[model samples]
Target chain A: MEKSKTNPNKDFYGKTLMGIEIFVRSLIEENVDVVFGCPGNAVLGIFDALLEISGIKIILARHEFGAVLSASGYARATGKPGVVVASSGPGASNLVTGIADANMDSVPLVIFTAQVPTKLIGNETFQEVDIVGITRPITKHNFLVTKIEELTSTIKSAFHIATTGRPGPVLVDLPRDILAEKFTFDYPEKVNLRGYNPIYSAHSGQIKRAAEIINNSLRPVIIAGGGVTISNAFGELRELARKINSPVATTLMGQGVYPEDDQLSLGMIGMHGTWYANNAVNESDCVIAIGSRLDERVTGDFNKFAPKAKKIHIDIDPSSISKNIKADVPIVGDVKDALKKLIPLVKNLNNEEWLSQIKKWKNEHPLKYKSTDKVSVPFVIEKLRDLTGANAVIVTDVGQFQMWTAQFFKFLYPRTHITSGGLGTMGFSLPASIGVAITVKDRPVISINGNRGFQINLQELATVTAYNLPIKILIFNDGHIDITRQWQELQWRKKFDEILIDSSCPDFIKIADAYGIQSFRVEMANEVEPTLKKALALKDKPVLIEFKTIYEENIFPYIPLGGSVSDIIEH
Target chain B: MRHTISILVENKFGVLTRIAGLFSAKGYNIESISVGPTEDPSISRMTIVTNGDDDQIEQIIKHLNKLIDILKVVDLTNEPFVERELALIKVKVNPYTRGDVIEISDIFRAKVVDIGPTTLTVEVTGKSDKITAMINMLAPYGIVELARTGVVALKREFKGEVYTSKEIKLIKKKSRQKQVEDDEKG
Candidate 1:
């Protein structure tokens, strides 16, 4: 609760401070509570400055990738800009995947990477790399800070750019000398970038046109995306849906935007989405897509996706409006503001026949999985959700388990279901879960990862135990990359190739023990519920539970690549 | 179709590279690019020429506008505009060909800026087509080297207001209200 003596009012204006300390103080001024990163040779000065900081907590991950992923998770959960730091050369290079993942998912992160001294840069110094050049394409904006005078302003600009208008990752590469240099700690109170204004309110003319279209259409569907959650417009979205009497469908990334328990909510739509949701999109006369780019996974074929419907696209990013599919009515603005403008102008519609047809499809296909004595992934996900209730945060890695968790786990609130839907990174769950635990201390955090994917960043077990975070790590041990095996079985005649990881995989329980965390392995169906209960009950420390699931089990109701959503193969 | 886009950006290091990197990474080809400082020393204007369909050009403009350093982007192809390019051509010539080259330059309204014993450098500023024609006419003398200043453009007179003054006032008011709401939330 102690405040820094060097407040922004007087003492901090012209007071001399190390560039590193000024940077840390700027983070404090921005109300950043925690940062995730690993230290290296070039960033020793920064770590030294952080050592004396009282308010900020730094979670040290075993790897740079883990640090960045954890920062991404923190950003997604808290709706704040996550801060991450890394060293020069390979350390900075290691953060590329996580940075790109965050960019694809529109998570706001301010990444700081150390560089070799300004003189040694471009001369192949021991740990020097052109990190700014390397990350230019992935970052929303980046800077290579060489002057001490520009340090504070650059950091401020980086945070502003990262958290504003269609948020994404921004990087600031600081040379060693810059961090070690002495300068006046003057942090700017406001950002005045003339070129960086974002349109937040929808144009009245466009909103009126959209309402007219909605009123005229016989059957309409509202397809919401991650923007709904990003803008915190779920309440407005639900209100607009009810006003128009339209069924709502969400993209895979848009899962938690609309409550799955609602009567009008058609679960996720697209590849691995619900049958009724896909059918509803294909059959509707008007499709109102808000904040989603309509990626290939969501729209099977660009030309065929919602072919019969008059599509209206609304988004904050102007490029995403008609980049993939042409929009009949394009409104460029923030989703929350656009929905607020639209709610009053739109009138109700009587689509009873359309709703009944969608109801029939939901009853017919209804996301079924084969019942067996062996433990199944979907069953475990359902049981976990039931036992944990809807309040717990669920994060999953990419694979069959991600889809199963997306399908079976009914999320009733926003920010509760976090996954890497865009970049589809494999080793994201564990570190991200640690981040979620840091942000939402009151809620239980559950991380689900497949065996092969979990081993990618298993070193984070040390981080989990170091913080003693009460996160429950659930590993679905399918003995291989089950999604790949499923593809080979259906298309390649079960050649199998090198997908098997049964023999080479380490004993997860022993691995957990090595990290000083409690571990459990459940092989039978009867033991699954009891073991999960035990894992969730451990509130003092972290626990890892490995569920031995059926190896050959495949996700059902999958729409093959390049296939139409209406042509889903449900087995 | 070929499109010409003019962008105003902050005069800062790596701004050009960032814009160029975006085009190359997205597989968009740039025919020519020219940048220079405006009356405001803190800002620079860049003119880029590229060929793409209507949709592709819209996307290019959108991406260009997304850069934080960029102040504004306008596609000259979408409006009635005046465009010009400047070129300096160094032509290898002998005494016999010198007279003919000078005559051709005179016909094209180009001036001879530099003259050597073996080469004559002609300076021409006009529409891109005129510059191209001048270069072609002097090419018969075995051109030694050539440099071009790409293309710079500006829209003609205002046709009318794209958005009514009333609408503009409403837009400004709405944006201000939204900002106040955001500040309240923060």
Candidate 2:
């Protein structure tokens, strides 16, 4: 066996590969199988290398946001950092909302953007935007590739950081000059990012302290946050909860972190959260907030949120400790790692009395909705969930319907429930659903959206049909932003401005028909399940089911910020 | 509840804009913000006052620190810090009250350097409370102009090092690598 003329010098060997090739090869090595992007002059080199690759398919999206959304959907589905590539300036700027959504949701994603040549960067060359700076707050970390030598390490670091503790989006901004430059590619053995030191394992002492706090409490409630899902610690969380016999209440983003059918599960808590879940949080002696920041939506009134409880916050982000609703015991590490450290230290005491008390609270304050003469959104969501067998992915746009879907649907698996919880970006559901459907071709994915949210991104309907995806869009067509409209009706006495759409939106049924997809509208309450079943029954192309809804509907169990979730104002 | 926080961050591109975007997206009202590079070459300090609860304020700080450019967040409200707010108040003073105003400025330890025929410009540097007190006393004299540098603070025992996020990161990285090396050699 002859090893032909290997370069004796390490530096000489490494100096042979181009930076773009190094970055591309690094991504492939990280098990990245696909990239969503559109190429331009700045990123022509990368596109050339990406073209030669046979396994990693590159999906050319019409818009940068669409590509990023598809990447986000991919991240949610696979629990790996999804990748999106875009050219400089407008292309990068368009990815802002998608990146912001990932930041807010803590979804793992990698966005690669081309910049103007290094020489023209400060000179404001054409199509040059400070993408790294643009994406700072919306990213876990970011890099500006200044040299060809840094490209390989930068890509590796970005992947490591993005998929690690408290996963979020990361951007690698490449200047055109660097991409055009030639350098040898040697994949870095390890990343050496200066400021990023993520602790994946919990400190044993802190974990023990947390366990002691949990053991000593009477009414202990596990306030599961998005962290559980991010860490893939559902099994551990379930075991710990079962060991302690404590009920688990989730934040909106915390859906699917625990099995919905678990006996100890109390469902989502906060504004528009279930009564039992909120009551459990309020009445608990100890509030073990795992991976949640206790955002205003979750806390309701901050001062009063779980006021009586001794808070124990376990999060990877240090700032989250005592940042919101001060924690008595704060454990800074990954939720899974924290649980692993703490579980053994905790005494397996059965809090049967506390559990029974919570059960009573659940029985007394079952989520009550007024039986209006009109068809209800919850009824539609419930039927849809049943027809799809809870196996279908549920995507919701933010509003009354978003909350209602949370209330109605029970998610058993992680990533099954995808919603814009952080950014709460409207029109996100349909595009994201299309992404999910594309990724999971066999699963029946459905986007349950409000009429207004559906209108915001209805243009994606063309993309849906163009791709021949099997996703179904169920729109709660109330004709306006019902959540904001309800507040307007209540606070301003019918001075409605923001919620009302001036121009009538195109008929979704007609629009779907034009797109060559099956469409239906259900007005009567009895017609909802049948309509949903019909839509689900069709597996060839996407379907749209529009339910005629009342214009001004409000989500109930409403705790205005800084108030206890238990003290809800029903609409 | 309202909180005024000072954040020292690296003067990287899009950082301030990103911070502004975050505040807007989160629906937090940013009452005032002043940002510029400090004594350090690379770092910039941003003074932002937001209205919300203590918890909300802390959350804002945490989220702000999450930005790659942000070095550290100092809730100057709790710490022993020197806060200065510069205000250029152009008061429409008649000759009769001009002397009295100057005397008052002397009493308050303020400087009245720019003087016009009908108006006098008083530059004051003090804590927000101190500035507000002087402004109230000067208000009765029919003030024609008012411009204020909202608020800026520095820690009293300040080491004049650049407080960029990058520097802090470098320190952390160094320490972590050292630890790994130590573990390997242990």
Candidate 3:
């Protein structure tokens, strides 16, 4: 059953240059439309090969981290394997965080990092790092190319593994010697990695059991997780929900899985989840959790979460099933395939008592805010939602504003909401939104940022303007790391509350102007929408709309640690 | 709401640790756990006692079976099955009341593996209830040591393969189609 390597034609031959040609050729043949990365000395040979190639657009990012994050955005938007290249050492190290972020969130990415020449390895060579060793814990798998001809198959396998089965990041580290070597290239027809097989087919017995449980339960709810979004199972999820006539609650990453305005949709649920979403979970007697791990954010106080509900967890990764919260039934397969089987079997689940109970809870504690003449964050988010018709792609950096966006913005489609949920990586909004804006050329892509989160990766602003991307960055300038300072002040009695900053900040409008992009400042509630519209009206280059507002604002509907969703703090 | 789950899996390296880590990482409470090799060398049986309802037990079973090396999982909480636990408890016994403990162990058919003037170790394998009954019987003699392997079970005559999602779908589809026809006629 194994392919014998006794055949001379199949043996790997030659040096680095031939390997580079073969590897780059395989990527081209796979129809990879773009690659985002920053090159260095070790990767110069590959760059030379890339120079001769056309049709694949290479985005030169300001930093390797920015490139990988942008690729992450592209992957999330298109369900494609995002590819990024980096030089040895520093270049490879820069990609570690982004690759880890993709791994944590299960985003498909093929990251190529150059290594020192094979002869110089383990000799403390210049610009060298043990990239493969360092990336073991973060990547699903990695490759170290020792042979020249193995390059094509290795790259092919990397792509295959990255995109298939519970997709995650994979690293392909090619040494300078391998890149300079010459070898005849032949792509492998199939992958046969022993012990690495991923199941794609749905097991019918489990589906029927899930259906039976759903039909028999008095109060049933469906909790959609990031798996649904990753699988592009929005239609399937909606169909199954409609068939069951069930209300749907989602994790932070599951925001765009369904139209937020749908009657059965309960919106995003977690630490700062909506009151209706959290309470709906509490009221359900049965929960059909598809593509979500039911993490701490989704299931606060694990013992008390969904106390009355039996869970049926559907996920592609077997490791996720009942790993956190218990499941009444577990279906280990692709979400799309599993849902396809469950759709026809789904029955009308009528629990009027449960429905009305959730409705009452929703009425008692809806997502509400009070705004004065000074301006409110929620009011700005509401205005943006209204201005964009709730249709624009929203990319958010982590902070108080990200939670506020989730609370206020009405997302109407899958992949329309993009953010680093699991990693919570700051400064992800601008570059990610720029990448999304490039592909979604006509539609507006808004990068919602906080003052602190924006400061982390503000250098990408130059990249945005250089590409002439029409990305609108709405900066919520609270003049501090408001979330942390608020936590320290609230929890620590403001002791050593040296966290708050009252100093005047750099004018973001002036910063954008320096980058050859449009800028506007909204210091009041009335000016928010008008400034936002001005930015959205731009056709070329990027725009920044800075909201100079109250700095002490905190995201409410907070679920204290070890507390249930019903214990939300309204303030 | 406590249940005993019996898992039959391949006796592969790291299987036990993987299962334990899974529960610990999820913050799931493991009330008690017992595992041992079965009559077949290639297969091992694990008995896990957890606190949860019927729904929770089902989830554990479904997830356990999903592990690549796991052959089957059976929730023997309510099913007609025979369950047992083996615990080699070392009791800190003195010269006094030593005979009473030996007499009690003999009554329960438990063998004394080692004996000392100050300590006595007993090896006993029986149903969890039987073990508890024996422990109660020996409690009066001033027992000092305690160790237990969680409960493991096997259905006396049950024979079938684990049902998967694919099979579940066909059953429901047929039933639904039948229901539609019945409704139309009615």
Candidate 4:
């Protein structure tokens, strides 16, 4: 208990500590058990400190990208903020995409990148890059510690900003010279931040007004997003929807916010949303957007998105409220708090006719893929979901496999679905799944990725073997980027730069084997289920199942860009 | 719609870039912006003047508040506020136009701080409109150079609230009415 404002460098009890040691102590205080990162010469002082500490453990990945992505997955699996400590220049630069992924997904992560000496900052020294400047836009907030005295308080602030109100990644860059310098460790007793207040509860008047509008509507629908998962508002979302007898549709990030198997569930909504979900949104009389930004991807066309409906948007960020669509009643608060206030005020009315209409649409436009001799990605996902009993954490890299999993997998619990939704960073799943497996030990952690994207962080397989994280990885090996190839074929593939077909055909099984991971390849449809069951059952070793799916299989019920929900293309 | 927004932020390096980056990233244009340290050396104030419709301006204000270093944000567009800007205009002053240039500077209440052999520099502090008017008058004299400190603004003391977002105008009006009714009752 020390006052940092009066004398920041004051010794707590007439003793000084190295900056890196102080950081390690602060991590222990923050209840962080492990940090994911790759160490370098710039951060050698930190590694020395870690060598002496027994309170914390560190996971060293092959690359900075893997390390950062692992931290992101760790944050998503647990509500607490994840931590990453990387070296300067290339190490920090390699983390850009993963850090952006965390920012876009609102995953809480506190990243530390060791910098060169203060004098060498502008002199173009070895391994010197303006990482703080490069990551400014992507990070929620960042701080560069030029003075040793400010290190402790800045780390505290970084954690606070990363974990609270619309959670996102924050970075703290410390020069090696500062870390090596001796400074008094004054851990402030209280956090004093003037500009970082987050509204946690809804204004009573706005909540009441929204409730009244929702109660009076004949057709009501709720669109939940990742914020629900971050807020732990799944129970509240369920309660509000059930009370109002409303159907629930979700954005890609909103996968597990509501149980997909429930009668009131309309699977994921928007671009690759279920036909019934998209139909319900288009035809609803009222649209209640909770914990979601109502992003352009989720709203196929802004003008036509829930156009006729009376809108109620509940989110932590005010800017997210009317950025894309002007909400009729914009409630700037945490969705859980807003929904808790809303459920009590709304009247319980069963819209039997509306529910029946949605049911009819579901029957007519069910998620269907042409079953052939070649096993499909959708089929594998369905098998994977069934084998895991809808309890495993599903992490997806970006592409058609991502959409397929969203379409077929039925998630029953919150924090059980993890993916690179907003930034859609390729090769995110392997490292992220390792983080997920570490955090959630009892349940299975599965990383489903496309062939080309999986190689983005294939080096992480060594980290996986090193740590012995018992996670399952699947690469739908259809060669080149399937989603891009699909779009090309649909619209002038002949005229464009040579179609990327059968490119980047790496032997994933061989690659996984080289890293000493148990890998299996399934060429036939019958081998998929048995292989998945066996892979998911392994408790000590990580497993990689290469499902040789056809590259031409495209995700359907896709709303073309600039097209409304009604303009879904079935081909 | 044009808006004058005043923001107080923690005095730190790179805060200006964060603010400027937000405007450009969102595709919003900042017509003119001015920033400097406030009375408290640890904090700085920024005055931003931008043109956009109501929705666009609303987003800008909300995004500004979202930045971690920003302490306070107030839109002085709808309030009674005093605005001032400093401009230095270097004008060509030949013998014929020298008297005319001095007369124009005196008419605008500007000071001819420096008088060179061929150029007269006028230092003026006034509302943006007044400065613009003087610049127009001196333009015919072949102005050599011009520099302006974008308008700095502060609301009149009678306007109470120091912090604002979206539409606190309704709250202010309601509170004023309540006060009036209480005064009558008393």
In the range B1-186, model 2's lDDT, one tens digit per residue, is 757789887776667777898898678998778888899968888998778977677778777766656777778766456678888889888889999999989988989879999999989888778888998999999888899888887766747464446668989899999999999999
**A-chain TM-score of every model:** 0.97, 0.93, 0.95, 0.96
What TM-score does each of the candidates earn? 0.93, 0.77, 0.76, 0.94
Tens digits of lDDT, candidate 2, A381-467? 777778877887888887888888888787777778888887888878887776677678767888888877777767777778777
For candidate 2, the per-residue lDDT at B9 reads 78
TM-score of 3: 0.76
iRMS for model 3? Answer: 5.8
TM-score of B-chain for each predicted structure, in order: 0.83, 0.78, 0.69, 0.84
Q: In order, what DockQ does each candidate have?
A: 0.62, 0.21, 0.05, 0.72
The deviation in Å at residue A497 for candidate 3 is 2.3
Q: Write the per-residue lDDT of candidate 1 for residues A105-210, one digit (tens) a residue.
A: 9999999999998998899999888999998999998999989998888888888999889999999999988878899887787787899998888898999999
Candidate 4 residue-wise lDDT, A321-394, digit = tens: 99999999999998889988989999998999999999999888898998877789999988888887898899
Q: Candidates 1 and 3: which is better by lDDT?
A: 1
Which scores higher on DockQ, 3 or 4? 4
How many clashes in each structure? 0, 13, 30, 0
**What is candidate 3's CA lDDT for residue A385?**
93
Local lDDT at B117 for model 2: 91
Winner by DockQ between candidate 3 and candidate 1: 1
